[model samples]
Target: MGTLTSILVLSFLIFFHELGHFLAARFFGVHVEVFSIGFGKKVFSKVVGNTQYCLSLIPLGGYVQMKGQDDMDPTKVSYDQDSYNTKAPWKRIIILFAGPFANFLLAFLLFIAVGSMGVNKYAPIIGKISENSPAFEAGIQENDRIVMINGVLIEAWEDVSTHIQESVGKLELKIERAGSVQTLIITPKINEYQNMFGEIKQKKMIGIAPSGKMIEVSYSADKVIGFAYDQTIKATTLILTSLQKLVEGVVSPKELGGIISIVQVTSEASEAGIVALFALTALISVNLGVLNLLPIPALDGGHIMFNAYELITKKAPSERVLTSMTTAGWLLLLSLMALSIFNDIYRLTNGN
Candidate 1:
């Protein structure tokens, strides 16, 4: 049941994302050749108004195929007129941006609904602290009420996790022990361990687990809006931080995951509470949306970049240049996919 639910949720998200592109293309009078719900071999398909909509065997990701999307012909201007390439640059940009925008809106709506229903927030009480860990070194004791991390006000234990995971190295913690406010300076330590996925370089040893005392507060309109806005901003910041770590070589390439990881995570999350599952889905959806907006070839960002260039220069790039870039982009994408899959397999075989 859990697995099925996860699969369904994932399918819904991907379908909506692709639908955004499809609808935008249709609105702009662009001829969309295909609308696929997944990649690889097609399992089922149907034609509707100059479009072949398909449900592929794999329930991974989906795509929309716009006519003349990748420099199909040089002499065919009429076909180009009805194609994605012939659209005005602003129209193309809007169509390109719609997918991610839809995901963002979805997440915002989810957050709003959850918040309006009065979500639970865990009480700020320490359950345990590792011996000689950062918490211990900083004079943090069990049963302390964690008030803040790095000067940010925290209402729940998740805020602590979010702040710690996002902030590297030393962190300033505020807590209330024995009705007295106390400040502690804690330094995070890196721990390398293999999981069923890869060698996860996670921050550890400052281990103070939060006590399980959940509280539900009445949800107000302000709270809903504020929480949703914060969620989007914080998630974006976290992604930027991870990217910086990746560039600095602190994060390994093997830590990168593909669709398999998403499925596994979604399945696990589905077994958790509704809020937990919703949060997971929203996180992944937002991540996918942001990732696609990156200026990498073979992606929406790449197409948007070309459009931007064309607008600025008042001329489209040559077919040769676009072809070469697309080819190189595919190769890079394939190589990354291979490495991630290899890492996943290796970790699984080693019982990591």
Candidate 2:
């Protein structure tokens, strides 16, 4: 059931992405030939207006086939008024960008839903303090709830870390212990820690850990929009940063996972309940948005780049260049997909 749910969710994401392109194309008076939910053999198809909507055998990804805009074959061209090739380069760029934009918009909405449903956060209660650490030397004890830091209210464990890292010298922490409030002054020391990307870095630390107590926080209507926007931006930035690290070889390619891993993790999220599922879905949606904007051939971003060049130069790329680049893009995409699948299988076999 979980696997099925994952597949359905993935398909819905693809559908939404392609719908962006389809709608944008139609808006500009371009004829859309086909709107497919996947690549390769078509298992189901139906003609609606001038566009043929289809479900393909592979459920990995999808595409929008606008007239005279064939990613598979750049040689195909039509100069008709309603064809994509006849549209202005700027207009075409907008049509290309719409797909990724839709993914971002969907992610933002998903985040809003998550915030409305309630987000689980660790309570600002100290669990452990390293010996001789700043927090320890200051007489900070386990089970003490951090109420404020440097005159700023600390609502969650996340707030504690932010406050500590941004502190200049001494931190004034207000804590509640045994229903009594007390203030403590502690000077944070530079400490080495491993980040999420497995990189070691030095940062200001008080050496305090959360007590593993969770609180469900639901945002108000106005606050939920801000929460959603912040979450969306953060997710987008995280994906972009991770990609940059991967390209710089700071992150090993062996850590990459494919559709199998997506399905597996999404299935687990489903079991964890609605909030987990929504958060994961939002992250994946943002991931799709960021990836589709990469400046590679045969992608939405690549096509946008091409159109932008024409818009600037008043000339389209030569047929030979377009065909060669598109072919190369497909090859690179396939190679990456193969590598990610291999990593996924390896992890499954090794129980990683």
Q: What do the candidate models score in CA lDDT, each in turn?
A: 0.79, 0.93
Regions more than 4 Å wrong, model 1: 71-80, 117-120, 126-154, 157-212, 216-218
* TM-score to native of every candidate shown: 0.75, 0.96
lDDT of 2 by residue, 200-267 (tens): 99999988899999988898998999999999999999999999999999999998989999999999
Writing each residue's lDDT as its tens digit, candidate 1 over 28-93 gives 999989998877899999999889999998876788888877423322344467788778998998
TM-score, cand. 1: 0.75
Question: How far is 326's C-alpha from truth in model 2 (Å)?
Answer: 1.0
Candidate 2, residue 252: Cα displacement in angstroms equals: 1.0
